[model samples]
Target: MLEQHATELLRHTVEETFPLAREVMTLDARQYTCPERFAQEKQQIFSRVPLVLAASCELRKPGDFKTVEVAGIPVLLVRNREGTVHALLNACTHRGAAVASGCGSAARFTCPYHGWTFAQDGDLVGIASSTDFGAVDKTALAMKRFPVTERAGLIWVILDPDSSHDPADMLGGIDELVAGFGFAGWNHIESRTMHGPNWKLTFDAHLEFYHVPVLHRETFGPERSNRAFYFSQGPHQRVVAPRGRPGDTAKDDLYALGRLPAADEPFDPLLVGEWILFPGASINTFYLNGQRGVLLSIVLPGPDVGTSTTTQTFLAETPPDEVTRAAMEELCTFLARVVGDEDLPTSALQQKALATGLLEHVRFGQNEGGLQHFHRWLDDLLKADDAELAALLAEPCPQR
Candidate 1:
């Protein structure tokens, strides 16, 4: 499916407004600035959604773990000795202190505030001065757990403790699409976090190509195309834009196949594109000295409407060699500069400007279908009653 569409996308990009949508849509600027709406979204969008937390390769071994705070909820994502990833509340059951911080392999997480220890599975296995406690119920003291699904090289979690939402519920058949890239086999190269504006504003940077040639021109080159081809599956979106001139399909077997070139392929060319996991995540292909790398990223909301934190992780088919390491560092440095020096600073200013109440509405053209899909779904979910939400949740996602 991607191959067929990629071929079509390459052909389409030769023309202007290559993949136009049905209509232009305008959103109220409040969608970017209203604190009340932002509060509702924290529940309807961020809390309820199955969020992509990390790549599977980031937790390939037993005891491997990573921690993140999503929408102000601290999460401890761990791979147990059984080789299953689980999302547990980072707070200790004893005194409500954080049980862990950062990422690494650990035998058990012991709270820094106290000596309370928890296994990767969230079992409250040890407590300081147990004799003094006099028969506390260990089972009842277990760390709260959230639903998690590890699929297609990604770890997804629904922050709700009792959530039934699986990765399939949010991703539809997108996991099948991602599985083709073999991200699980890739070696982790870099992982870093950056501060940004409101979560939505930071996210808006990932949804369209309208600013690509202008905002990213210094890094992306002069011939980069502004036109984008968008493919939406339910609330998620995929974006394809021109990297350079389209490849000659008949000139080689790889291009003829209309697929993204493999890591070892002599040439890494633009073919199939990038993805936006609904809410605030993105999976994109990267090139480091002509070698292929994969990036998985997420923008997380902070304590309120005005602040956000972003984490980006890069991986390669294998651990980098000396020359490849230099290339990887150069590519990552360039990405950091373009995002920090360019995209993020501008988005942060947009957030500040939106809060001034000067503009009541903002417009989105056909080119911004990704943003439209997100905000529209948010509106629908916010207006829904519990029953309505359940029925909507049960509705089959459009895989095509």
Candidate 2:
């Protein structure tokens, strides 16, 4: 199946045939400006969906844990001695103080407020002065566990404890799409957070390369092609430039495929584009000093409608040497500047314009099918009830 997809891309390259939507699509500017709509999205989409929370390598060993907040919900992720990952509400049962903060390794956590101790599995094991605290069912007070699963070298967690939707089902086989990357064995180098405009606005810029030549003209535009081919399985999508297209960083290496036998074609070119795990995670491959690295960009809703936080996590296939490490740092800094100086500042300006109520809608061209599909899925999810959501995800995801 992977080879077939690669062959299809090669054929498109030779034919100059990139797919397009039926027509131009327009979205309401208010989708990025309205607080009520943002709140609804928080409830219906962000809270209910299985989000890409952390890379598998972040907690490669047992007893490793990390804490992150999603849509105002504090979550604690721990890898137990049994090699299983668990997601628990970070709040302590007694006074609701967060028992954990940041990432580190620990066998157990004790709430600072009253010394309520919880094991790696979230069992309430020790309570300060339990004899004086009175008899309470410890089992009933175990930290509330949310649905969590690790797949394709990433950690996925749903915020709702009672959600019927399975994280695997929600992914719709996207794990297979990225299985070639072998991300579980990767090593996380570093992570940093950057502020952006509305979450949707920040993510919209990633869905299509239509603005690459314009918005990223100084850096990527000169050598890259603006054209792209989008392939999707459910809400997850991969954006690829045709084989030998200048947009591909390895286009020179791919040109050899034209004369090479089909069986001899390399598989690396097929994985050379952006892979988006929906609601908001975009994974892109990069190379520095001849060492491969992946940049995982996770965008989560902020405290308000006008703000969003993006965590950029960089992972390398193997540990880097001093030279590669320096190159990686340079590359990371360059990307931060591109996003912070170019993309997000423009989005903030767009937000201000839309807030003025002067522009009624935003336009997406026929070529911008990715944005169309994303917004349509958002609409569908927003209107679905819990039961309907289960049924919706249960349907088989169509192949590209």
Estimate every model's Cα lDDT from 0 to 1: 0.77, 0.84
Q: How many backbone clashes does candidate 1 have?
A: 1
Q: Over the stretch 1-400, how does candidate 2's per-residue lDDT look in tens digits? A: 4555666777777787887888889898999999999999999988788899999999999999998877678899999999999999999998899999999999999999999999998999999999999999999999999999888999999888888778877777778778778899999988888888799999998888888888889867555677777777777788776545553355223444553335565455657678989899999888766678989999988878998888888999889999999889888888888888889899899989999999999998888888887898899899998877866654536532
The list of candidate 2 runs beyond 4 A from truth reads 221-223, 243-266, 394-400
Q: Write the per-residue lDDT of candidate 1 for residues 100-189, one digit (tens) a residue.
A: 889999989999987999998999999899998779999899999998887778888888887655645555666766677777788888
Off by over 4 Å in 1: 10-17, 242-271, 384-400
| Candidate 2 structure lDDT | 0.84
